[model samples]
Structures are given as C-alpha cells and as structure tokens.
Target: MVSKRGRIDTFVAKRLQIPKKMVRNLIASEQLFIDGHQVLTADTQIDEFSLIECQGNVLQQRQRAYWMLNKPKGVVSATIDNQHVTALDLLAGIDKDLLHIAGRLDLNSTGLLLITNDAKWSQRLMAPKSKVTKRYLVTLANPIDSTYVAAFAQGMWFEYEGITTQPAKLTVLSKHQAMVELKEGKYHQIKRMFGRFQNPVIELHRESVGEIRLDDELGEGEFRALSTAEIHSINVNASV
Candidate 1:
C-alpha cells in the first residue's frame, strides 16, 4: 500500500493483506520506513508518494533487493565454512536474518551472484523454474576446438552425483577462452564439463545474472544499497 496521508501501520497492513501485529512489530523494531528513512512509530502517516520499506518480509509486495555480486576468486561463498572467512564476512553490519547469499559460487570461481534479505527474490532468482540467465567467462589451459563447441551447443552430457545435466550454451569467445550461458547452475559444472574435453579451466568469472550485472565501478569487497529502480526491474524481467 502507498504511504498515503492519514494511514497507520494497522491500516497499511490491512491494505497490503499482511497481519497487523506483524506490521506493528516491524515498526517497533525500527524496520518500517518512510521514504527510505526508518520510522519507529507505526502511527506515523505520510503522503501516497512516500516510499515504504517494511523490514517485515511482504511476499506479495516484491520490493526488496539482494545485490548481485561478481564474486572474486579466493573468497569463499558460504556463510560459514569451517569457520573460515566467507563472502558473508563482507556484509559487516547487516542483520543476519535480513541478509543471505542468493546462490552458490565456488571459492576459485568468480562471477555474478545474488545476495539479499528478500527470500522471494532469492527463491525466484535461484529457482530452476525461473530460468534466469547466467553468463560466465572462462579461461582454459588449452585452446578450444570446434568439435567441443558443437557438442556443447547441441547439449553435452554432464554427470555428477547421480544426475545428468541437460544441454547448455557453449560458445568459444577466443582461442583460449569461452563464454557459457546456462539456465541451471551445478556444482563445479563449468570446470567439470570442460574437463571432459581435455581443456581444464584456469580461471572463471561470472559476468551477469538475469537483469542485474555487477557494477564495474564497485571495487572488490565494496557494496552499495540496492535502489528501488533496480528492485523493480526484477519483477519486470521475471514476467517475460
């Protein structure tokens, strides 16, 4: 619901179809907001144009964003990995419950990854049914050949743990490099699949995921809050 004049927490909750008590709790916790500023009192009212950011997770509202990171090599993606420093370490002050990595990225592989407090955004971006496009740039030890390219584009077989992967895009970007766009992400997939071709991947970088791309200006380990425009783009692209 818009932050209309004369509206309160209870009214907004009812309009959004969320429980009033839950909305009140968010307000009490200083999680409710008016135009990006936190509001502690639920009774605070504003004009319809005021932006509302509920620290409360509203499934139907779909307004929060998880950042897409172009993960760098040597950084573990897990939140807790044998007590070793992981990607979560970079999110210094974020509330644990409001933040989580959207998907997996191997320690050696770097690329576009989603991190967010919004569970629906996470699920929608990572779910197989969503078919969100994921692109990667790979460096190989040996030059790629036409034979490998044909087999990959035609749907090469990938077997791991008890499952075989469906076909994926495998196009050569350069003599010793290739670009792969995949809809499904598997464990050590890019390295494993190309290993069959006798060309081991030396380095990997994820360029983009879905409609979001890693900001080139953001240095490694630096982060910025997601804007409302970026968040809105998620829904706009998902429908297509």
Candidate 2:
C-alpha cells in the first residue's frame, strides 16, 4: 500500500459513494470489517490495500503492484517532473499514482528500475542492514587498472558525508569498462568514487538488484509486472 494512514470513515465513504455519517453508522453498528476484523471506530486507520467489507459486500480490495522498468537514459526516476519525462509517465494507462520507485537511477543512467506500491517491501531492500547487492555496468573515460579494484575493495572515504563507503566489488571487463557491485548506494557514489582517479563515468547502467535481473526482452522505456518469485525474493533472507 502506498499509504495506510487514511481514516476508515473517509476511506469507506469514498469507496462506497456514501456520506460520512452513513459510513460512521456502518462502523458503529459493527457492519464494517477490515481484513475480516469488525471495525469499532470510524477513525480506524486503513489503506487502499485493506480488504474492506460491509454487510458481506466488499468495498475495497486492492493488491500491491510491483514492476520493473528497463529505464531509458534521460528519464527521471520520479512521479512528476516539471522539465523532463518521469518514469511514471511511461506506464501509460496504469494507476501509477499508487506506485513509487524502489531503487532510483540517475537521469542519464539506464537499466533495471524497480517500481512498487508496497513500501515495506522496498524498505527491506533498501535498508542498509539488508545488504542487498546492486550490480552496475560502467564505462569510464580513462583506462581501468588494478589500483581501482583495490581502492574499491577497501572502500573510499567520502568527505561530504564524512564516512567510508562499504566495500564494493570491481571486476574489470576491458580497458575502459567494468562491472561494479555495491551493497550500499550513496549520493553520486559511483561517480564520486571514480572522481578519485579523475576518471569520468562515460556510461552507467544497472544490471541487477539482489536476485532480480532486468528482463532481456523488455526494450528501453518498457516495463512489466514483477513475477511472484521475484517479488518474494527480497523477503527470503531479510525481515520485511
């Protein structure tokens, strides 16, 4: 659920197209049930994902939605942007207002981007203790060397944050390209790390997050609902 902070009376009235007083009556009379429990107060908090029933009629029963986008370069990972096309704009007809980006990519970065209506699920993945790994394919302006690999493994210190980064893995694929795996994401972390060598990142693309890989079949700017297995993978080792 995007938000579970709504009051029951307001939620019920809107869903049933009835007055607030009538919805309150339903709650007072014990006719309203949320997730099979009788509602005792009109002020009881509820969310769109809650299964609400009134006298055997289900009023709202929304399931959480999860999606993965093969993000295209130049698309902002946002719900709304005044100057650029946002990631939500690419969903077309779907009810995107309820969804949010789980892991964000830079405007110029491309590849696997997770979108979901489940906040807890996203929280579990992003939580530092979870240590969920993110893999990125990077193209650099300068030639790569073993020194970069050692520096990354030892973790670099960021002066702005006054903290050392978590150790990251760097696999040199070519003279100018490499694969980077990190357990944490800091603001401009990758770019800043490479900035130590005065090496600008020419290209950056996420290849995967944790156990879910970007689907090869999806073209740029295209997206699809995540599979049941993919959605459950994040919960396998960590508490959600």
Candidate 3:
C-alpha cells in the first residue's frame, strides 16, 4: 500500500493482516491469484495498479507517478542527505523515496528536473550512448563571441579526463548569456569548457531535456505529473 511495487507475498500479508508465513501458506494453498491466474510463488512482482484477487477480494495497485520539478538553486538532487536539503524535500503528498531523479542538477544549478519511479525510463534517458539532448541556459562572466560556436561544435578537451567532449551546440543569446546543448554529460562540463577561455560561469540552468521542456507555468520547487505524450517523448532506442 505504501509503495507501488512489492512482492505479492508482502501485499497478501499486508492486506490480510497476517504474518508473511501465513501468506506463504496461502500461496502454497493456491489462494492467491494474480490477474486471474493462480500463482504458486510469493515473489511475483506486482505494481500499484495490479489486479490481485485472493478468494474474491480485489487488491488494488498503486498508480505509478511521474513529475517534473523546476528545481531551485541550493537543493541537492538526491533522496536524502545529512548536510543539504534535497529536491525531494520540495515535493508534497507523495512517497519521495519511491521516486528517483532521472537527471541530476548541481547544487548551484537549477531548472527542468525530472522525477519518476520508472527505472527503465530513467535509464534510457541517462544511458551514455543515448543521444538525448540536454539544453541549458548559461550565464558567463565574459562577453560572447562567434568563435565559441566553432569551438563548442568541435568539442573541448578536458585535461583531467584526457578526452575531448562530444560536439555541442552553442547559441549566443546575449553578451553574458548563451544557450548550450549537449548529448552527453560531463562533470562541470560547461564550466570547465568555458574555463578554457578564462570565462567563468556566473549562473547555469537546465532549460530542457530531449523533447520535454520545462513548464513555464510551474514555479521553482513546484512539480506536475508528466503527460502521456511527454512521457512518450523519451527515446529508448540506443542503437543508432
């Protein structure tokens, strides 16, 4: 009940208010039927929306939830932390632990943070081989120029990794602000890339990920469940 996913035996025990051993006995007795088929194993995985009928009584499934948060600065992208408040703390009326951060925003950065319980969906988005584009609004301490376009398009070398980053798209929005799009994530990538020109980053915010753009109506710290179409935008095809 508290979680959307769990073993069938645990659900049976909770629903019947009996011990797990009793649930196992009931499973052995063929009293538990999952989706109308009698199951001998208590380990049958069930979701929040599973139709579990045991001796004519129906067990409800917990509906999966997905959300997008306009993450505010200073909130760490984590479920729990001892020193800093996490983005999950900003959410209300949901099981925070059940949800996960698909893409992390740095403590000093903000915008378009996705929250979901679907592991496969998140995995697809984070897969290194996936070409899903992440767009960011970057503020720099120096003025912008056309040379950055060619440099970013060609990729930047990070000495620490001894590897050049994947080609990125950089569009100048203003003297101090620019739009940057990348298909891969690197540690402090934008900051490090700009550091090559001695141009420090003043501010950073993620504007979008793939086809899912940040909701203009949602304020920082607020979130809403992703629409069906929005969820469909995630491309799981890894082979290209």
Candidate 4:
C-alpha cells in the first residue's frame, strides 16, 4: 500500500488498532524502528513503503487489494482531484487513498476501471511491453460501414502523434455503434480513428481489459473487490 504521510505513532496506532499512548510508550522503550533505524519519538513521518517494526517484530500491513469499478461519467480517474470527485471516492470501507488506478477512463467515458494497491501490477498492466488488450464500445454521430473496419485492421497513422497505431480489432455493432479492441493506448485513439471518416464519436465505454471483464452486475459508480482468479487475470496475456 502507498503510505500516506503522517506521524509514525499515529499511523502505528491506527494500523495496529491500538491506542496512541501505547504507541508512544513503545517508541520510548526503543521498540519501534522505521526501515531499520530506531526512533525515539512517534512524531517522525512515515516514508512511503517503509517497514515498521515493534520490539524487533515487523508489523503486518494489510493485504493489497485489486478492484474493478463501473466508473461513473463525472469522476476523474485519479487518487486526488481538486475540482472533481475521483473514482477512488466511490469505494467505501477501505483506505481508498492507498489504491491506484491501473487503466484510466476519460472523464466522460464510463465503464470497467481497474484499481489496485499493487504498484508493480498496475505498472505492468499499463506498460507498452505487456500489450494487454483493452476493449471499448463506441457510438458514433454517423453511420459507419465496412471501410471503417478495414482501415482499423490495417492500422492508421495518427498525424498528431506522428505514429501508426498497432492494428486494432473493430466489430460493427450497428450503423452508429461498434466494439473495438486495441493492444495499445493512444491519446483519443478511437475518436481520432473515426475522425478520419468525418464521423464524430458520441459516446465511448470501456468493456474490459485483458481477460478481466467488468461485471455486468455492477451498476455505474459501483465497485467490487476482485476475486483471486480475477486478480490473476491481469497477468494473463489474451487477445480480446
């Protein structure tokens, strides 16, 4: 879990479910150390990912959590935001601040969003080398045709990014809606792809990442902790 800055004593008290006075007494007895250095006062700030020990025994931190959220349209995909509510805020009964978003949804787009406290897992999920497939449902302003599918399959050169995107899978659902799967994230990739054909995107919703699909049971703004099998899905490389 990402450590929130606070007094070592206060953090220990809350984390261990003990009293602050007891934490102070433990520190005074030279029973506490932050990352292997003995500290006399509880006032010391806890550093991120620092190990805490009491009387030579390491304190057990809570297990890391992996969750899937049906992100609402208005919330930002961040841990903290000054002017908007973040997706983490929807989570209850947990240290939401310790959680980090794996794949981000745009502010107006809504769908399956991944959140977790495992930094390395999140990092790997977003890494270019992983090539995890991300699936989205897109609605367009105009009716689309076979040309759109062919173009996407062949890969398109995005002028703004000055790079050709990897070949993407596009399936036409209706004249104005389609389902797309991409192995790489580009800035506004779907919208930009349709822009080539003079069609504006009316809506976009993510449906899944890798093998971990958003639970259909989850309504907008609702989230559920991932099961062990679902958590393991992040490590699996599968085509959407």
Best by lDDT: 2
lDDT tens readout by residue for model 2, 35-95 = 9999998888886688989999998877889999999999999998999999999998788
Better of 1 and 4 by lDDT: 4
Ranking by TM-score: 2, 3, 4, 1
In order, candidate lDDTs are 0.71, 0.91, 0.86, 0.85
lDDT assessment of candidate 3: 0.86
In candidate 3, residue 103 scores what lDDT?
A: 87
Give the residue spans of candidate 2 off by over 4 A.
1-3, 6-24, 40-45, 55-58
| Tens digits of lDDT, candidate 1, 141-194 | 998877777676665565446666656787887899988888888888788889
lDDT per residue, candidate 3, 34-127, as tens digits? 8788978879998755778887777764456679999998999998899998888888887764688888989999999998877767878878
Query: RMSD in angstroms, all models?
Result: 8.6, 2.5, 3.8, 6.4
Candidate 2 weakest lDDT stretch, 10 residues: 1-10
Each candidate's number of clashing pairs is 1, 0, 4, 0
Against the correct fold, how does model 4 do in TM-score?
Answer: 0.77
Give lDDT tens digits, candidate 4, residues 53-82: 888778744467789999988899998899
Error of 4 at 214 (Å): 0.7
